[model samples]
Target: MAERSSTMKTPLNKALAQRRSKRRYSRRSCGEGTYLGYTSGRQTVLKIPTSRKKPKSRDITNQVDPDQVALLVKKEWHLSYVTPLYQFRYTMLKTYSKELSAFLVSEKQQGQTIETGQELCFKVNISVVLGLAETNQDAETIYIQILSKQVFAAKDEAQKVVWSGLLTCINGDVDYLRSLPPEFVSLPLLCTSGPESLSALVKSWLKKTFDCCFGPICITSTNLQWLAALWTGCHPTKNIQYLKLAWTIPTQPPMDVTYKVNPQDVWKLWDSARLDDGAEDSINIEEVNSFIRGLQTHFFRHFRLDLSAGSLMRVSTALGSAHHSGKIKITSPDYMTTVLQLLTECALLKMPI
Candidate 1:
């Protein structure tokens, strides 16, 4: 019985040894360091050490110094392709006897102003809210609304605005800034809202005398007759580039809302015979076209316009038919549709590449 037991034990031990050798050979061929053994029933299996050097434990004391650590921040700028509101810097310097000191700030300083403002009310596309503007009214000083939330301003001392800077103003107001003399106002851009500003008054005065070729003009009312007047050499406002239109909506209390014309206005220009009536030379054709192109492309591209998609489809269909006939003719009772049709013709005639 003892001899038979020994014989069985010998075969079992030999089989185990053969398995271990095969594992070592396979691990070496595979280029793995070694096979860490797994559990077999209640026993734990272990791999033979390939090297005498023990694996060192991680150094718990080795750590990064707090002073040596660096913090990284990322910044972003508005893209001109995506937004029509181009970024520009306009700073204002003020001098007064009221013991107020002014500090000139960079375009970056504009952000500091907006961060400290009261409540963010209206935000169009691009806007910067400086501090607040206090206007003396009725022999009393009143804190007017956020001076320039959309317009940028420099940092001011106390709650009062000493000297201001328009880091930038977006949309239609950008056009008005072109007409202003440098460093004249609290900010570069003029107020598009409220009663006509001093700049508007000056531009209006210039328009009356026709002394200036270009002026920041405000139109209270819009009519096709005005376009005819400019075309027929009645009054030359063609040079008047920065035009702000006030749409008067009468409520319980009448209020005038200042708004830039939509891209549909470009369509209006197309329908007019003025552009084609041999009066193109008399008018600032280049300026008008340029303004139209800018409005249609950039301004329209950025802002949301409630243009009728159905109207556009119909206009496209009409244009296709006209193109095939080698003659263009579009007639529509809807004003915007008519404008669309005329624009298509103009594009074909002038902008066709």
Candidate 2:
């Protein structure tokens, strides 16, 4: 507005020009206070670290190594849906108390390399109650339970524990673990199953562990043969009786006790006989006794007061061939007249108790 100025640039315009020129220059070369008008044009002090970059993962397998974690399964336990055992160690971080998910990521990245059969070690808490699990003199069974439930119980424990496959483990192929003994080794299911079911495993483990924990059975088997896997930890007489009892036809139904029976074990001795189909199932004395009892009762009733010829005939037919089994021979009339004569004799005796 004032006509006295020859130069046309205003003070504001000069300041703006200086600012543009300053922006063109390297900020490092400019004086500390120089204004270039870029966002937050001044460097500020930071008390905390900011230059650290987020780490990148190096894992490619989504798997770790030290594999061999599928052999530790118990005979009685049910296993399903298993990842390899070694991966457990990679997945879990050991600690007293921490978030489960957080612990899973310890020092491990998505693509990091892990050993085969790496397992996550877990510390479990178990309080002993007598008569519940058994007297816990040392309280170590808890550790066994944890291993069984978490890592070894995984369908893959045979791979992780003793290095075995599903079929091998179930089919009695993994006997190396038996040498270790349950007490010393802390196997998952310590006292169950046969060779097919881990009974052999159970027996060997008992001998080893029981010897270590308690001591030798003061009474070792007089006959070493009695100590075999077929022995079943029972006396000879009782074993035979049990076999007989086992033979009873289960009032309910019969099942296969021979081996590889997946489930259900209730049956009378008679029922067990079906297993014998005269085949793989072992037959004992009790079952045969039951058969004899049924046969004798069904075919002949010699103690009756109302015996008749027909009844006598049946008795003779049943007993004539079977008499070899009895110490005493019965003298009854022949079939035609036996019933009538027996009635007269029974009337004379009058001993119908």
Highest-scoring model, lDDT: 1
Score each candidate by Cα lDDT: 0.21, 0.20
- Evaluate model 1: give its TM-score: 0.17
317-345 per-residue lDDT for model 1 (tens digits): 21111221112222211121222222212
Lowest summed-lDDT stretch of 10 residues in model 1?
A: 1-10
Residue 217 CA displacement from its true place in model 2, Å: 14
How well does candidate 1 score on lDDT at residue 298?
32
Worst 10 residues of 2 by lDDT: 42-51
lDDT of 2 at 322: 10
